[model samples]
Target: MEKLRIVFMGTPDFAVGILDTIYQNNYEIVGVITAPDKPAGRGQKVSTSAVKEYAVSKNLHLLQPTNLKSEDFLAELKSLNANLHVVVAFRMLPEVVWKMPKLGTFNLHASLLPEYRGAAPINWAIINGETKTGVTTFFIDDKIDTGAMIMSKELFIGDEESAGELHDRLMHLGSDAVVETLQLIETGKASTTIQAENDEIKTAYKLNKENCKIDWSQSGKMIFDQIRGLSPYPAAWTFIKDGENEWNVKIYAASFEAKEHDELVGKISTTKKEIFIATKDGILKIVSLQFPGKKRMLAHELLNGISFSENTIAL
Candidate 1:
């Protein structure tokens, strides 16, 4: 068997776990490629990607490519002379790059192949109210997430799980799956199944402010799903008004009751200790939220500081 020399590619904290798993297993990581350092957060401070930090901490050869197709970047990638490439949470690869490795490149996607095949799989799966989502390791092709599957493993989605929670679980599961795939490839025992075309697949559309905005007219369950799906990042939001003052609020946690309610849609009902919003068919209780210029807090804690009148409505 030919010894495997790997080049790993990814950004974000999610990829760090998988890359660590491979390194711990003693893979010959020839080079690491990640997005360049860029400004982030309220301070606009330059930040290095999670992958870069891990690579540097372990003294791995690293490349920060601004353009995947640039001659310099390509030459650097080629110089690594790696047989395999493993990508997780990385940007799309040009043909020249994905096809460069002798053992070919593979990607670890957060969702099962042929479903939720896009950028925001974790968020979309919870938003769509899926009971199950999983991880897949597949040979990278020219198209996005449409690749020959080497292995897949299933995980049950908890009814109360947020995208952040699910993301952590999938990251660990993916680490295991990727390690298994690497072993199969190294031993020449891998058998890949080509992904089939399916129009009914639910896509993980890129998240944006437009989609993150909360709509009170939706059913309590739907609005609830939206909240958890977007929680911890790009949180679901709404405009809350107390007849006199309106505040755009970011909702991080909530529960829902599907019973019919006479309260006007978007109405915010508050007891001394809790807050609930009327939806199309029921009520959504606000658990954790943030007000503009304020940190996130429980609804009751927020109410202690800022009261909501009976006329208050979540717009």
Candidate 2:
């Protein structure tokens, strides 16, 4: 096998894991392309991507191009003399960039091809209540995620798993998948498959704040899944009107109980032990929550402070 010179492009914690794997496997990472540092947080400090930080740590040559198609950036990339390029969790590439590498550019996507073939794949699969999802490595083309597939690996979505939980699992799993794909490419034993367009296809569009709000009209299980899908970040929230004061409550950990409810739907019921909110089908017991203008806390602790009486309806 010829010694392969590779250029890596990615920009998140998920991408960082795969970058580390390639480094450890003795793959010659000639250069790393990551997103430019931008202002973040209250302090407005310049924040570098996780990939950039990792690249600096390993003393690898790094590039942060604001525009991939710019002549200077393309020239710099060509200087690396890379035969192959790897992309993960990065923006769509231009033809000039993807076509520059002789061995062709390949992307390690988080979902199985022809399904969940968009951004936020892991989040959408769990949000839609799918039983399984996986990762894929494919050649890069002009169309987004529509290319000849190199290989794919499927994994079961564990019961009661949240998006964040599944994300961590796929990150490590994806690293091995990329390494395996590269091994096949090196041995010239890799084959390609055309993607199928069927009605069973799923997409992972980006999650918005409006969609994260909990809807009480849904069944307890559906509401629970929504909450779990968005938990820990961009959380599932509900509003409670306390007289004229509206309180935003972000619900994190919850469980569904199909118990006899004496109150109307969307009503708040509370005991010293738990705080249950009535849904269309059953009550959702909120084990963890955060009141407006306050940090996250246990339901028991929140119940002690806030007065969630009979008329306190969660929006």
User: Which prediction has the highest lDDT against the true structure?
Assistant: 1
For model 2, how does the per-residue alpha-carbon lDDT over 38-101 read when each residue is reduced to its tens digit? 9999899999999999999999999999999999999999999999999999999999999998
Which ranges in model 2 have alpha carbons more than 4 Å from their true place?
Answer: 259-262
| Worst lDDT 10-window in candidate 2 | 303-312
**Local error of candidate 1 at 287, Å?**
0.6
TM-score of 2: 0.95
- Local accuracy by lDDT, each model: 0.93, 0.88
Clashing pairs in 2: none
**Which residue segments of model 1 deviate by more than 4 Å?**
none
Which candidate achieves the best TM-score against the true structure? 1
